[model samples]
Target chain A: MIRFEEVNFAYGARSVLRSVSLSVGFHERVAVLGGSGEGKTTILKLILGLIRPDTGSIIIDGDDITRRSESELRETRMKFSIVFQEGALFDSLDVKENVAFCLREYTDMSEDEINARVRHILASVGVEQALELMPEELSGGMHRRVSIARSLALDTPRMFLYDEPTTGLDPVNADNICGLIAELSKNGKGFIMVTHKVSDALKVADRFIFLRNGSLLFDGNRHELLNSDHPDIMIFINEVCIQGPSGA
Target chain B: MDVKRTISDLQDFYSLSLHGLLGIAGRPFYFKDALLQMDYAGAGSVVIVVIVDLFVGMALSLQLAAELSSLGLKMYIGMIVGISVVRELGPVVTALVFTGRVGAGMASELGSMALGHQVDTIRVFGLDPVKKLVTPRIVSSLIMLPALTVIGVAVSLLGGYYIAVFVSHQSGTVYWTSIRNILTVENVLAGASKPFIFAYLISSICCYMGLSTRGGSVGLRQATTRAVVMSIVMIIVADFVLTRMLLYVLGFSV
Candidate 1:
């Protein structure tokens, strides 16, 4: 489980998260929905212990990481993995090396074992053909798939954090990624995704979190979101409707 | 430059450099990465060092012979060139060139990694960026710079030899003997120590700049430029300071 208690964050005077508090159960599938620069990414980073809250505490897997040293945080981070917005693949490494990185670092697996494991993970993610290709050679969707494969390299990580995973891609690729997330969600592990794409979020996550101006405005399932009377929530739904009619 | 910012940067640089040095004692040392960096910093740099130092030695010999022949001291050309190149020019020029080649490359590569989120990815995988990236670079620079300086000194002596024995018509035996006689223990120590210091300064400065990169490509370009400029300036300044301190400590007449 992960818990944020009255967490506040700022970027040198410009507050991003303001007295925000939330929690995620071990097997929960959550989508944090917000506009651009509404501190969505900041929330994901905080969960990963990538950045600390200015005030209050964050507890991950029952351990408070608020003031933990970087070395300590490294141990905590082993419980989770993050896929950045752009896939954030190591440009210098080929897809195989990137996917095999964590396994090689933390596990005593033999070379053949590591290769087999990488191949299995890549096959699971449907990017097995990209094993020898560099990051630049992969398509946008393929890059994100490879990123997901890399994240799944570690057997111990129980939660996955996705930061705008489908932000920049064509409709077909976006749908493919949404489908991938849906497929991964069935594994019974926690997932926390921050994205502006409401339709895609509605497709995969059972719980939705709405952030407006750095504070949670709504937190519930699809029924509550569709039936919400909050003016801002209604405005957001209407705007998405006006932009394009979504099935969700 | 803002004085406060400059001081703050220095403090950060010192802290990071100290952390990098201490990392040598930590667990999970990346020996393979260090060896790869050594190849990049040492073997990749030999040809350039040899060529540059050769020209510099030849130029120094030409000027020194012209001036010394008038004073009937042309045979002393090897001594002057040897002492100057071994104690000062070889290390300084090598460090400056390294700052341009390897140091700038370090900053840009790391800057791109920082921007691309690869550094953060390393952290997420339970790895220390300092240990994984900066330490190997610092270690490689520490080992390679001094080795290159030795090579530079030897090639420089050969350059001086060619000018002294062939161009200036001095006896090859006299020139070689003069170099052998002038390079005392103190002079060798002075020459040997400067490369280590310059290597530390260059690697740390470049690594700090690379990891601190912000914005985007513009920020990366600025960081790379700043790293090269700062390292070059620091090398020259450190060379002067080390020369003066080594002279006094080694009991050489100032």
Candidate 2:
């Protein structure tokens, strides 16, 4: 399980996360929902050991990753994969190379083995046809899928961290991403997504967390989230679901 | 107003610079990246160097020929071209060219990465940005600049020779003999020394400017421009300082 205890992060004098505590059990598909700049990405970065909490601890799978050495952190990182908002694939490398990057860096696997594994992951993400394509050539949705394929190449019991997976996609492509998240969750990967999309969250998130003012305002199952008497939750749902007269 | 804070900032800057240096030690030595950087620095600057060197060499030969002809010593044209090209023009021109091409390119690319959060991505991956990005560039520039300066010296002399022999119609044999006589160990050593120092200055300044960039696209542009200008200025200043020091040590009049 991934756990945060009394986490507090501040940028200069301004506090971002204050005494925030949260946890995700093994095989849990948790959606952290919050509006923009509410420390959603900060939580993910802390989990990834990208940044340290000012005064707290982050423990993952029995290991306190917060203070691990760089090599140790890299070893731990192999257990998880992140799909950044913009995909973050190296522009000079093609889809195949991008997927095989970690493998090439950390493993002594032969070219044939790397190629086979890359092909398998690409096929799994439904981006096998884009193996030869550059990042600039891929659509936004396709780029995200390619990033997923790259993440899956390690094939560990991965924790897939997505930051606004559906931000720039059309509704159809957004639905496709939701479906992909659902499929990954069904496959038993620990999928933690940060999003404001109620429909997407409801479709794939088994557990929901609403963060407000740097603290967890709500943490419950999807059914509980949909059936809650909370006014804030209701407002969030309305904002995501309710369209204008002509459909926004 | 805040002396302690100022001291702390200075301390942090030194620590960061040391961190950057140590970080550079961990990257895989990429020969391909080195070759690409060299090509960008050296091959791309050939045309400009050739054009400028041709005019400079021709003008120097013309002035020297006119002065020496009055004393019936016109054959010393080759000596003049040889000493100037080997000891000063070659290294300085190569550095100026590198400042324009590779220094600006490094600053802009690294600055973009700083702005785009790619450097953060690298850090998260347990990779030091300095190691992965800056080290290979620094090492490559250090190695390649001297090699490029040699090429520059050759080209400049050839341009000078062509102007002296064909354009000016000075005796080819006399010109060649004068060059052979005047070419000394100090001249070659001095010429070779300049580029290594210039490479370090240019690469470090560019990398420093790049990593220090804040804001976004506008900030990156400013860093690139600053890197080029700083590198050029530093190279010129260093040239004067190094020349004086070298001449003093060699018992030569400055």
Candidate 3:
């Protein structure tokens, strides 16, 4: 459903992504794992057409978006929804308004219909009581769930991108987010989660792609990731993943 | 070069202003958003304009009366107060006050949103942030600045009236008569025109400063300050240009 062909991107003299390439198919939830500043989030940005690659093409839903203008790329982006690293809820709006944002903008659904779906999605995320609360009033976990609900409010989201959704949270909240990802996975929808959480990734990811220093280090299923002979990959999967920082 | 930077800034502001206005006329507009913003920026700022203009009028009358009394022209103080407030002080002061209040608010609110990635979320959802954020502000500023200016001019004239009649011992009827005679269609047109442009200048600059914010908290702070400072500078320069143009266009002496 999404493909990055030899993508290269940089900020001034500092390179962020280098000749990296990967593809995600339908029914596959790929987790891109790396430590901080390893271009994990950049992949989401490239796919969203928020930033263009220095070289290579980002194809989403069979359309190349590397050079698409901002206005033109918006149509291509309608097929995808993203949850930013910080949940990115609009502070001026309540949870109800935040979740109903895209629906009100893009859908012709009546206010009551929109409210019904918003209530249902908020319930699914376990935050229906938070519907009237402002973004600042919600807990970290509730904010993350509301952000997800906002993304899900869109009509057809072929791909969902989550950037460190569980980055700043207790284990309980992290598990709640993992459960949400797991639930989304069961629907056979494609997802690309950029996180440093190894245990979280293992909990919800069907395939893992590890990015290191702007390059792809490993790409395989869970069985292959655990059984691989690569020393650092093994150390990471066994030791670091178990004991390393969950949100670095 | 400072000259080069000024030219570039003006060019960029012009382009953004065009885009902001286009969004007001384009499809998918949030009319409710624009109305709410007008209430937020316009109606919200009117009281301040009136309060400030009233005191300014009193002070202006006092100073002008002192100067005129020395020359035995104390009776003409109303002409100076009325013309100055209408032709210059009213619009400019209202804009500066609004810049500090409403303009700074636009910058900080939008700046915080940019830092929080809400702007990016709007983009990812295939919505234009310019339309969602900038247009409403521009629309409100466009509306409030002029209305506030008219109210401000009236309040200042009333303030001037108190000072001229009681403080300076001038006849109230004579003072109002001079003001009524000098306040022509041309004078009203000239006084009323600048606020519209200043409103656009302040809102657009602040919005641009906000949308281009970088870093995090520190950047938001800088964007807010820059929005006010840059807008003041922009408003002053625009006032000078517009004043000169309107003076000539309305057939008044520059």
Candidate closer to the true structure by lDDT (higher is better), 1 or 2 = 1
lDDT on C-alpha atoms for all candidate structures: 0.91, 0.79, 0.88
Off by over 4 Å in 3: A229-235, A239-248, B1-13
Q: Score the docking of each candidate (DockQ).
A: 0.83, 0.36, 0.84
Looking at candidate 1 chain A, the ten consecutive residues that score lowest on lDDT are A239-248
Docking class of 2: acceptable
Candidate 3 lDDT over B1-254, as tens digits, reads 58987898778768777899889888987888989889988788878988999999999998998889999998898889989999899988989999999999999998888888889899988988888899989988898889999999999999999999889899999889989987999888889889989998899989988887889889999999999999999888988898889888888763
lDDT of 3 by residue, A137-223 (tens): 888999999999998887587878999989999989998898898897677687889888777888788899988889999999888
lDDT of 1 at B1: 72
Residue B33 lDDT, candidate 1, scale 0-100? 86
> Higher DockQ: candidate 1 or 3?
3
Please give the distance, in angstroms, between residue A32's alpha carbon in candidate 2 and its true position after superposition.
1.8
Interface root-mean-square deviation, each candidate: 0.8, 2.4, 0.7
Stretches of candidate 2 off by over 4 Å are A11-15, A61-72, A228-231, A243-248, B1-27, B59-76, B166-169, B248-253
* Local lDDT at B56 for model 1: 90
Which whole-number lDDT from 0 to 100 does residue B110 have in model 3? 89
lDDT of 3: 0.88
* Model 2 C-alpha lDDT per residue in residues A55-76, reported as the tens digit of each score: 9899998899878866578766
- Model 3, C-alpha of A213: deviation from truth (Å): 1.1
When sorted by TM-score, best at the front, the candidate numbers are 1, 3, 2
